[model samples]
Target: MPLPTDTYRALTQSVSAELASLRASTPDVMKAFGDLGRAAMADGALDKKTKELIALALGVAAHCDPCIAFHTQALAKLGATRQEIDETLGVTVYMGGGPSAMYAASAIKAFDEAAGATRG
Candidate 1:
């Protein structure tokens, strides 16, 4: 079954508190991580949308729920359609096999929720 519409959002919110604490304790490391993320997602040969898609796929493959949530939210804001998300999930599953298939479901739920949140 798909996750609840608010699940990913809630998960992200919960993670944010812990992440904030970690960042407070490890400011330099957190800043470096944030910088890396910004640099990786910057528009270049590939646009931010495409980069987000790749990141979403990798997030699913890695079973990283927060990554999936963040990237799906990014993808939705970037105007990614459901078809695009599904196609990316297809590639993610093919590359990462059964485990990825599990997380891909969550990824789509994340996308849908984020898309709806943007609209509402």
Candidate 2:
């Protein structure tokens, strides 16, 4: 099933609030992240697919459920296959050991749901 609009909205708002708070408390960190993001975007060596995969890996490493879900959808929209997504999550499992397994599963489900919408 598609995630409810309210759920999506709340997730977006919460993430925004958290990011805003982080920016306020650690402006340098936010600036650094922004710079790194820009640099990554500028690097033509990594295609959009590879970049989303990298983002997925980071989301898994950070244990951010919302980020995982969001990036999963983004990757799916970019035409990443289910197998590719699973493989990416497997990498996360290898890096994060055990606790990340569940998060990866959840992310996969989120990706599937998002993909379903686009297919239909």
Candidate 3:
């Protein structure tokens, strides 16, 4: 399904709330997972923006709608241009094959939606 412009923010907010609840319920596990994600995405060899694009490509490769939405918004917020996103999608399509191509399209739709959101 094509991603609606509002869906990205809604999904992210919903997920954030759910995750916060889960963190309270399973503090140890959630903390570990959250810490790991933060650590992996932190600036080091690659900047945060690069990591976000890598993550966005990974989201497409994995065919995770929520991940695509989340990463699309993150990439936009980090100032990724269309060219960079297209390049990342190219690699994603190459690595992930036919299925990834479909998801990559979805990712693009989500990215456009996210970009629109920031404008207004």
Q: Tell me, by TM-score, which candidate is best.
A: 1
* Residue 37 shift from truth in candidate 2, angstroms: 3.0
Against the hidden true structure, what lDDT does model 3 obtain? 0.87
Each prediction's TM-score versus the true structure: 0.93, 0.70, 0.88
Model 2 ranges with Cα > 4 A deviation: 1-10, 13-39
Best by lDDT: 1
Give the alpha carbon lDDT tens digit for every residue of 2-107 in model 1. Answer: 4334588887787887799899999999999999999999999999999999999989988998889889888889999999999999999999999999999889
All candidates: CA RMSD (Å): 2.2, 4.2, 2.1
Candidate 2 lDDT over 25-113, as tens digits, reads 99999999989977875548788788888888888778776777667767777899999989998988998987678777767767787
Ranking by lDDT: 1, 3, 2
* Candidate numbers, best TM-score first, in rank order: 1, 3, 2
lDDT of each: 0.90, 0.76, 0.87
lDDT of each residue in 38-111, candidate 3, tens digit only: 99999999999999999998888887888988999988888888889999999999998999999998888888
Pairs of residues clashing in candidate 3: none
Q: lDDT score, residue 98, model 3?
A: 97
The residue-level lDDT of candidate 3 at 42 comes to 97
After superposition of all CA atoms, the RMSD between model 2 and the true structure is: 4.2
